[model samples]
Target: MQALTDLPSLQQVAASLTEYWSPRVVAEFDDSYVKVAKVHGSLAWHSHEHEDEVFFVLKGHLRIELAQGAVELPEGALYVVPKGVEHNPVAEQECHIMLIDKKSTLHTGNVTTEKTRSLNEQLRPL
Candidate 1:
């Protein structure tokens, strides 16, 4: 696992993806879990009431849509969505991103949908 491994390559982990929207845990540091996901299309609008989510674009482009506005993130860009803010992520094309969030964070806040994934699913080996 990542705890015993040395500096993992995000690219390699991202390249191992076989589907969209599914995130794989890569490491854990303190209260946060580092993950990577290949995304396309849009994720349901949701919010984490008690945790902020950190998103870093690794490739392609991503857009974080909030109730009042939206931010477009290109490769090498990063953004942090504060807790309790309703937002959705959309990628017009396949995009790879790294997410840093608490271990207790849910897949999609209070709303469960077809895209929602359990923590066990996220922790699967890449």
Candidate 2:
């Protein structure tokens, strides 16, 4: 069995993230992948074409803006953006967040702008 102590602390994971709009992979299990990110200001508008993504606020507040509406997620709160839905995430201050999604999921689906990134490119320190 795995022990919780064996897992890295969120603080340690947060330290490894170096850029905005980029998420670093921390762990994976079955069909889901876990990522950590440090965010500030606004992120590019994008969407996942084939997978839903969960955003969990670990430190500060996170705002998710969609075509229908926008939601504010404070620390300890979580929000799930369904597949094929266009959404943009924003942070007023430096915020730490965790994301859960399928292994094949892309951070920004089909939209290959400067903001699009790969999970491998955003690996966090373990």
Candidate 3:
């Protein structure tokens, strides 16, 4: 994993971002990755077969649209999308988020979209 944060301030890193829906790797912990992203609009509907994805709202708001229900997260809130659950993340305006995902997790799970990000691309220096 790559990051500018030796003494990483999540807010500062989030503020430095210039891309939408692009998540940058910030650190690695055991079998999981710590990533940050600025997002707007909707990501494709997808599901991770076995990996649980955790999202922490750093700024703005987020809604995790699930088949059964949608989870709303305001800044400082967090939500976890359990394994095998189909979900889509949506933000009406710009939002910053921190995510914790397993090493084997794919950005868009089983679905590939224009917004999908590869692990190598995410691992690039932050």
Summing lDDT over every window of 10 consecutive residues in candidate 1, give the lowest-scoring window: 1-10
> Judged by lDDT against the true structure, how good is candidate 2?
0.85
Sort by TM-score, top down from the best: 3, 1, 2
RMSD in Å for all candidates: 2.4, 2.3, 2.8
Prediction 2 TM-score vs. true: 0.87
lDDT for position 2 in model 2: 81
TM-score of every model versus the real structure: 0.93, 0.87, 0.93
Q: Can you tell me which runs of candidate 3 are displaced by over 4 Å?
A: 1-6
How many residue pairs clash per model? Answer: 0, 0, 0
Which ranges of candidate 2 are over 4 A from the true structure? Answer: 1-6, 124-126
**lDDT of each residue in 1-108, candidate 3, tens digit only:** 666446668877878888888889999999999999999999989999999999999999999999999999999999999999999999998999999999999999
- What do the candidate models score in CA lDDT, each in turn? 0.93, 0.85, 0.93
Candidate 1 residue pairs in clash (backbone atoms < 3 Å): none
Identify the superior model by lDDT, candidate 1 or candidate 2. Answer: 1
Model 1 Cα RMSD, Å? Answer: 2.4
Model 2 agreement with the true structure over 1-126: per-residue lDDT tens digits = 889888778766876667877888888899888888888988778888889999999989999999999999999999999999999899999999999989989877757778777776866454
